[model samples]
Target: MQKAPERLIDENGFRLDGRRPEEFRPIKLQVGILDNPDGSAFIEQGKNKIIVGVYGPREIHPKHMVLPDRAVIRCRYRMAPFSTEERKNPAPSRREIEISKVIREALEPAVMPEYYPRTVIDIFVEALQCDGGTRCAGIVAASLALADAGISMRELVSACSVGKVEGQIVADLFDLEDKYGEADMPVAIMPNLNKVTLIQMDGKLSRDEFERAFEMALDGCRKIRNLQAEALKRRCEVLTGTEMPEKGSLEAH
Candidate 1:
């Protein structure tokens, strides 16, 4: 088996990547980037590329599962055949199922499901390229897609990952670092309320290190929330042919 690359330059620095101990990679997001879906978004953070599509509040099939007083959020997460270093099979694997469940649960609390009872909202996320933190990327993309669909939510959902590599805590682990790094922690947060909706971690961390990584991830989440909001505003302006009126401008109208 090939050994993982050594990523620690020294006890206190990064290897070749320019990121500091608690820095995230540059992120880019585009909303309504797809033509076929009711809502869509493309997101890139580091080497990870994910596209998400949301459809729904339409009708429920296999009708037995429809609820009487709330809509159901159905989520599917998949990796494209060439998304990874190794080609993946064309079916949803157990890992994808697990991630879909986690993502659905993460956004469930934020969605106003009672508004569309007996309807189904379908969200599909495809990993176009894989690095670390694909699940978190999926969550972020899904939130944007939902917003693009004009679904009411308590707040936007944003996510980021942090890790420990080379004995130092870091934010937003890239592909190589995640493969060889000591610990990886991914979190989804509701920035408006400073609350966490999703959290997961692997590897070892002392209490101090955990606190450091948690703080770093939360900061990243806030940064991502800003980006998501900007993307949504741009999309709305394009779709409506009008800019968002400045705050309280409607009162003048």
Candidate 2:
């Protein structure tokens, strides 16, 4: 088990990386990053680096699992063997299995699977590096990939994690904070729908604390949602040769 931070927060109210309590680590998103996948994206948030690809709306194998009225959503969340301080086993761990199911469920609400009945949409997310919050980061990238792949959807799903560390509620818990924090909660929301798809907690917290952390997580997700939109916009521009607006303007005048 990982041990707690000797000091989760300094008297100056900064985390070990000199971040403020409510601050999220920097995030970088790029869409259509892979050529083979129908849609793909890459993200680097804080110390976590992840890549996600969306494939299909293709036929489902083992045909019996196919839904007559909607498409099947399959998600695989994996961590590279060298992603952590210690080499993770190449085989999936129990936590990874649970997280895979969590991610699939979290993204289901945003997809209009009914349009692609008898098909399947497969999402693959792999972590190249991690410090914490990899799951939420994966959600952001996966949503972008889905859009890049042209999957019909109601809205993108965004996610973030918040927790109480050192008796202070902080947004975007990292490795040390999570290992020692009193509470670590990860929340995913459909950005435009304003509905939560997933909210899981690993530690105890008072109702008041939970409410505050929940709001913080939502706020973080909103910020991430904007970034995701921008990524998709940029990807579109690149594909349509609209990067130089003077000749091929996407903006209406």
Which candidate tops TM-score? Answer: 2
- The residue pairs found clashing in candidate 2 are none
Minimal lDDT window, size 10, model 1: 244-253
Q: Which pairs of residues have clashing backbones in candidate 1?
A: none
Instruction: Estimate the overall C-alpha local distance difference test score of candidate 1.
Output: 0.86
Q: Which residue ranges in model 1 land beyond 4 Å of their true spot?
A: 1-3, 10-12, 242-253
Per-residue accuracy of model 1 over 126-170 as CA lDDT, tens digit each: 999988899898998899999888898999999999988878888
Worst 10 residues of 2 by lDDT: 244-253
TM-score of model 1 (CA atoms) = 0.92
